[model samples]
Target: MSDKLPQNRNNEEVDLLVLFDYFGKSINRVINFFYKIIKGIFSFFIYALKPFIRNFKLIASVVLVSAILGFIIQKTQRDVYTSQMLVKPYFDSKYQLVTNIKYYNALINEKDYAQLQEIFNISEEDTKQIISFDIHSGPENENDKIVQYDEFLKSIDSSRAKNISFKEFVENRSIYSGDVFQIEVFSHKKDIFRSLEEGLNTTFTNTYSVKKMQKRDSLISIERQNILSSIKQVDSLQKVYIDVMNDEANSNKGSYTTKDGMSFIQERTKTKEYELLKESMQLRQALSELDAQKVEEDVYFDTLSSFQDTGEKYTSIWRVYTLIFPLAAFVTLCFVFTGKNIIRFIVNYEA
Candidate 1:
C-alpha cells in the first residue's frame, strides 16, 4: 500500500505539471495573436506612409504654392466693414423674412434702383454697397419639433387668436412665434449700412399683419369705442341721480306723512343714487383697461438684442485661413497623390 501510494503521488505530480504547461501555452498563444494583430496594423501604416514620405518634396511644393495663393487672395480681398441690427421681427415663418431678403437682393442685383427705393427705401448707392441681407435662427432647424413657449402662448391664443382653432393652434405651435426674430444686414459701407438699417426696419414695420392679429386689432378698437360711449352715458345717468338727490334736499329732505302714509322722495330716490354710483364705478374700471391697451394696425419688431458694431464683425481674416488652409491643402494633396499612385500602379501592372 505504501509503495502504491508513492507511485500515485508521482503520477499526480506529473498530471499537475502537464496541466500547468498546457495553460501556459494557451496564454502564450493568446498573447501572440494580439501582438501579431497590433504589429500588422503598425506595419500597414508604415508601408502606406512610406510612399507619401518619399514624395515629401512634391507634396511640400504643392502645399506651399497653394498656401501662398490663398494668402495672396486673402490679402487682395477688401476688408468688409459691417454694421448690423439684431432685431426681432414679427413674422409667422422666419423663412418668409428670408424669402423677402432674397427678393430684395434680386431687386438690387437687377439694378432696379427706383424699385428698390420704393420697396425698401434704400438709395442706389446704399444698395450697391450692401453685400447681403440675411436671416438666421437657432438650432431648432426646419424639421425640428417646436415645443410650446409655455402656457403664456396658450393664454395668448385664448385671448386673441381666431383664424386658427385653439386645437389646431396648439397642435401646430412651434418654437418660433413671430413675436421674436433676427434681422441681419452685411455691407462694406458703414454709412449705407446705417441708413439702410433704418429704412428696412421701417419698411418691414408696414408689412401686412396676420389675419388673426388684424381681427384682434379691430375688436380692440370697437371695444374701446364702446367703453368710451358707455362712460359718457353712465356719467350722464350719475349726474341725473345726483340732481334728484339735490332737488329732494332742496325741497327739505324732511319727510311728511301722507294720507296713505307712504313717503314719496324717500321711497323713490333712497337706494337709486347709491346703485347708480356703484355701477358707474364698475364701468369706469372696465373702460380704464380699454384706454390702456395700445392697439396697432400692423405687427412690429422690438429690438430684443441691440446691434453692436464689433459683434457683427468677424476676427482677423487670416485667422480663419490659418485653420482652414492647412486642412484643405492636406486633403487635396492626399486625393491627388493617392489617385496618381493608383493610376501609375495599374498602368505598370498592365505593361
Candidate 2:
C-alpha cells in the first residue's frame, strides 16, 4: 500500500507540472504578440516622422513666413476709423421724472438730420463735401438732408471725419429711462478729438437745457393739480359751515331780546369760520405761486443731474470698450496659436 501511494503521488505531481507548463506557454504567446504589435506601430510612426524631422529648418521657415504674412495683412488693412459724438439728454432725477425709453429709442432711430448738423456745426456748403448717409429707413426728404450732413461731416479738415461715422465713434450707445447719456468720437487722427469734444459739449449742453424745460412743464402740471386740490377742500369746508349757520338761524324762534344774544354768538362763530376758510384759500393761492418758483429750481437741478450722469456713463462705457476689445483680440490670437501648435505636435509625435 505504501509503494502504491508513492506512485499515486508521483502521478499527481506530474499532472500539476503539466498544468503549470501550459499556463506559462500561453502567457509567453500573449506577451510576444502584444510586443510585436507595439513595435510595428512604433516603426510606422518613425517612418512617417522621418521627413519632417529631417527638414526642421524648412518647417521653421514656413511657420515664420505664415506669421509675417498674418502680421503684414493685419497692419496694412487696419480700419482707420474717425469718430465724433452726439449726446442724448438724460432723464432729470431731481424732478423725479424720467424720459420714456420707447420715446427715446424712437428718437434715436429717427435720426434727426437737422439736429445732427447743428450739433456737428456743419455748414450748408460744407455739407456738399464728403458725406455718405446710409439711411436704414425708407427714402424721405430727410435722406438728401442727411446726405448733405454726411458730406459736411466728411468735409471737416480734422481727422475726426475720416473713415468713421458719427454713430460709430460714440462709445456709449445705451438708452436708459433714468438720467444717463453718452457720446463717442472716433478718428484716425488723434488731433480731431479736441474739436469733437468741444462741439459735442456745446451741443449736449443745449439738449440738456431743452429737456429740462420740458420736464419742468410736466412738474408744474403736477403742482398745479395739488394746488387745485387744496382749493377744492377749502371751498367744500366753507360750504358746509355756511349751510350749518343757515340751518341754525332758521330753527331759532324767540323774542327779539332772546334771539339777539344767540344771533350775536352765531354771527361771531360764523365770522371766525369764514376767516379760517379765507386763510386756507389764500394758502392754496400762495402754494400755487411757490410751485412756479419750485418749477424753475427743479429745472436747474434736473439739468445739472443730467450733465453729471451723462459724463459718468460716458467714462464707464468707454473704459469697458478699451479693455474688452484688446483683451478679446489677444485671447482669440492665443487660442488660435495654441490649438494649431498642439495639433501639429500631436500629429508629428504620432507619425
Candidate 3:
C-alpha cells in the first residue's frame, strides 16, 4: 500500500505540471494576437496622416488668409443690445395680457404710428430701429391647470404656440394667479431700447390691460346685483314665514299645538330664518370685498423687476480675432488640403 501511495503522488504532480504548461501557451498566443492588431492600427493612422504632413506649409498659408478675412468681416457687423423688464400679469387678466401681445405686434408691424404714439407715448424718432418687442415666459409649476393643459396640447401636437396669430393660445388654457413674465426690447441703439421699454409699460397699462380690467369690473357688478337680488328674495320669504307663524299663535290664543300645524313659540322657524339672514350677510360681505379689490387692482403695470440694460461692449480687434481666428484657420486648412487631394485623385484616375 505504501508503494502504491508514492506512485499515485508522482502521477498527480505530473498532471498538475501539464495543466500549467498548457495555460501558459494559451496566454502567450492571446497576447501576440492583440499586439499584432495594435501595430496594424498604428501603421494605418501614420499612412492616413502623410498627406496633411506633406502639405503643411501650403495649409498654413490658407489658414492665415482665412483667419484674417473672418476677423475683418466679423468686425464690421453691428452689435445689437437687448433690454429686459419683468412684470407679474394681473390675476384675472393674465390670459388677456398674453393674447394682447399679438394685437400690439400688429400695430408695430403696420406702422400705425399715430395709434402707437397715443398708446405708448413714444416719439417718432424713438420708434426708429426698434427691432422688436417680445414677451418670454418661464416654465411654471406642472401642477398649475393652465400649464397642465398647455403641456398636454404640446405633447399631442408638439407645437402649442402663443402670440403668433389672431387666435391666441391662451384662449384654450386656464389662467394662473399673477404669473411673472419677461418683456424684452431689442434695438440697435441704447436710447431706443430704453424708450421702447418705457413705452411698452405705458401701452400695457393704458390700452390692453385697462380694457380688460374694465371688462372685469362690469362682470363683478353683474355678480354683485345677482347676489343682492338673492339676498332680498331670501329675506322676503323669511319675513312671510314669520308673519304666518305669529298670526297662527295669536289666533290660537296661547294654545299652540302640533295638531294645528303650529309649534309652541315657533323656535324652529326662527332658527331657519336666522340661517337665511346669516347667508345673506355673507353674500353682502363678499360683494363689498370685491368692490374694494376693484379699487386697488383696477390699474395694471405691476413691474416686478426694472433694471437698465447694461450697455454692450464693442468687439475689440484682438477679441474678435481670438474668437474667429483659430476655428476659421483650422477649417480652412482642412478644406484646402482635402480639396487639393480630391482634385489630385480625379486627375490620377483620368490618367
Candidate 4:
C-alpha cells in the first residue's frame, strides 16, 4: 500500500510540471506575435525612406526649390507698414459739477450731418465705417496706462480724408487730464497724419460744443425744478388761506353782532388767498417757460453728443483694415508654402 502511494504522488507531480510548460509556451507565442508586428512596422518605415535615400539628387533639388520659393515669398510680398498715433482724452473739469453738459452741447449747437461730412471729406453713409470708441479710466501703472492709451487711440477711424489716409487723428485726439486720458492712432503710413489730424481736431472741437449744450441743459433743469417747487408752495398757501376763510364764514352765519368781526376776518382771508392764487399762477407761468427752455437744451445736448460720437467712431474705423491686411497676408503665405510643399511631396512620391 505504501509503495503504491509513493508512485501515485510522483505521477501527480509529473502531470503538474507538464501543465506549467504548456502555459509558458502559450505566453511565448503571444510575445513572438507582438515582436513580429513591431518588426514589420519598422520595416515599412525603412521601405518608405528608400526613395528619399536612393535619390539624393531629387531630395536636394526639392529642398533647393522650396528654399528659393520661401525666399521669393518673403521678399516680393510688400511689407505692411504700421504707424501709430497717441491720444489723451479729457473730460470737462466741470462735468461732475454740471450734469449732462457734454451730452447737451453735442445735441444743440453742432453742425448738421451734411456740414460734418463736408468738413471731414466723407459721405454721411461712411459714418458706419467707424467701429470702436473705448474710454479707459485710471490705470494704476504708468506702462499699463500708456498701453491703455495706445489701445484707445487704435480704436478710432483710419480712413482716407481728401486723398490722404487718416493717421493724424490719434495724436490730435489727445485730451489733457493730468495722466488720466490718452489716445493712440495707428496707420500704414505717416502721410495720412495731416488729414487725420484735421479731422480729429474738427471732431473734438464740435464735441466741446456739445459739452456746452449739455451744461445749458443742466442749468435749465435746475431752473425748472426751482420753478416747480415755488409753484407748489404758492398753491399750498392759497389753499390754506381759502380754508380759513370758509371756516370763519360758516361759524358766524346766523350770529347778528359777531358777524361783523367774522366778515372782517373772512374779508382779510379772501384777499390773502387771492394774492396767493395770483402768485401761484405766476409760478406756473415761470415753470412753463423753464420747461420750454429745458426742451430746447435737451434737443441741443442730444445733437452734440451724437455728432461727437460719430466723429470719434469715424477716426477709429481704420484699425480694422490695418489689423486684417497683415494677418491676411501672413495666412496667405502660410497656405501657399504648406500647399506647395504638400503637392510637391505627393507628386514626387507617386512618381
Off by over 4 Å in 4: 83-351
lDDT of 1 by residue, 84-202 (tens): 55555554434455566778778767877787677657666766766666665433442332333344356665556445554575466653443455566666665455456555655
For all candidates, the clash counts are: 0, 10, 0, 36
Give lDDT tens digits, candidate 4, residues 257-324.
Answer: 45456432324333476677778888888878877765544432121111111122123323344444
Residue-level lDDT of model 3, residues 186-241, one tens digit each, is: 65677555545555654444455566777888998899889889878988888898
Per-residue lDDT of 32-79 in model 2, one digit per residue for the tens? 999999999999788656655765666566555555655565546423
Clashing pairs in 2: 45-351, 82-186, 82-187, 83-185, 83-186, 83-187, 131-150, 131-151, 169-184, 170-184
TM-score leader: 1
Worst 10 residues of 1 by lDDT: 138-147
Worst 10 residues of 4 by lDDT: 301-310
Off by over 4 Å in 2: 1-56, 66-88, 91-119, 122-179, 197-219, 228-351
C-alpha lDDT of candidate 3 relative to the true structure: 0.67
Write down the TM-score of every candidate: 0.65, 0.30, 0.55, 0.32
Model 3, which residues run further than 4 Å from truth? 1-14, 29-67, 87-128, 131-134, 138-180, 197-219, 233-281, 292-321, 335-351
Which has the greatest lDDT?
A: 3
